[model samples]
Target: MSDLSKRRLKLWIRLLGVTRGAENHLRDYLRREHATTLPRFDVMAALWRRRDGVTMSELSRMLLVSNGNATAVVDRLEADGLARREAEDGDRRRIRVRLTPAGLTSFEAMATGHEAEVDAIFDRLSDNDLDTMREILTRAGKAT
Candidate 1:
């Protein structure tokens, strides 16, 4: 095998291992807190970061989920009063989803502790290594 092929294979293994470790920690913590799954948290996080509400279609694209998947998730969030769907007067069919004030507060509380724990999970990484990892991962995401 070529040297580059071996290097790429190692990178893939490392990526999967690191991701699984972090995900498992997070999943366990969130479950203990309130039985929140990662997918639900991800949907809330996407809305949390966006100042202006995102359209349902746009959210599906951002989350790399199918439109039906996004719709089902949104339905649950709406039923829980965490999110609200607004119809545009200009286009009645277009539905934009926004987090309620309650949702914002909930996400903030959860995110604070979540960030601290996740940060410590990678505390061993040097600043330079962290930066490089973020850059590489960001590029990889764009490629996908």
Candidate 2:
């Protein structure tokens, strides 16, 4: 293989490794500190972004997950009083889900800790390093 092809393959592997490591660390932090799984946090985060609420189909699409998966998470959230589902005004078959007041409070606390944990994870990276990495990754993502 050409030098360029070899380097690209290595870069891909390194990128995957970094991504997985960061994800694993975040998972552990969330589980240990908040007793929540990544999926549950992700679902709450999505709902937190949309105050008006979202349909199950929309939520599934947003999370890039299957309907069943989204439904399962939502089920747990609802059971925990973190979320609620209401019948769509014009469509009885459709439902819109939103975070409850308790959910909002819980997610706010979680989000604050989540941000801190992420920051600590990359505390060694200087501001310039972050800027350069962000630019490189943005360009690479655009290529795909």
- lDDT per residue for candidate 1 within 1-144, as digits (tens), equals 999999989999998998999999998888888568788888889999985789999999999999898888889889999999998666878978989998898888889878987998999999999899899889989977
Considering only N, C-alpha and C atoms within 3 Å, which residue pairs clash in candidate 2? none
Error of 2 at 81 (Å): 0.3
How many Å off is the CA of 76 in candidate 1? Answer: 1.1
Q: After superposition, how far is residue 29 of candidate 1 from its true place, in Å?
A: 1.5
Best by TM-score: 2
Error of 1 at 139 (Å): 6.7
Model 2: which ten-residue window has the lowest total lDDT? 85-94
What lDDT would each prediction earn against the true structure? Answer: 0.88, 0.96
Best lDDT goes to which candidate?
2
| Regions of model 1 farther than 4 Å from truth | 135-144
List CA RMSD, all candidates: 2.2, 1.0
For candidate 1, the per-residue lDDT at 66 reads 93
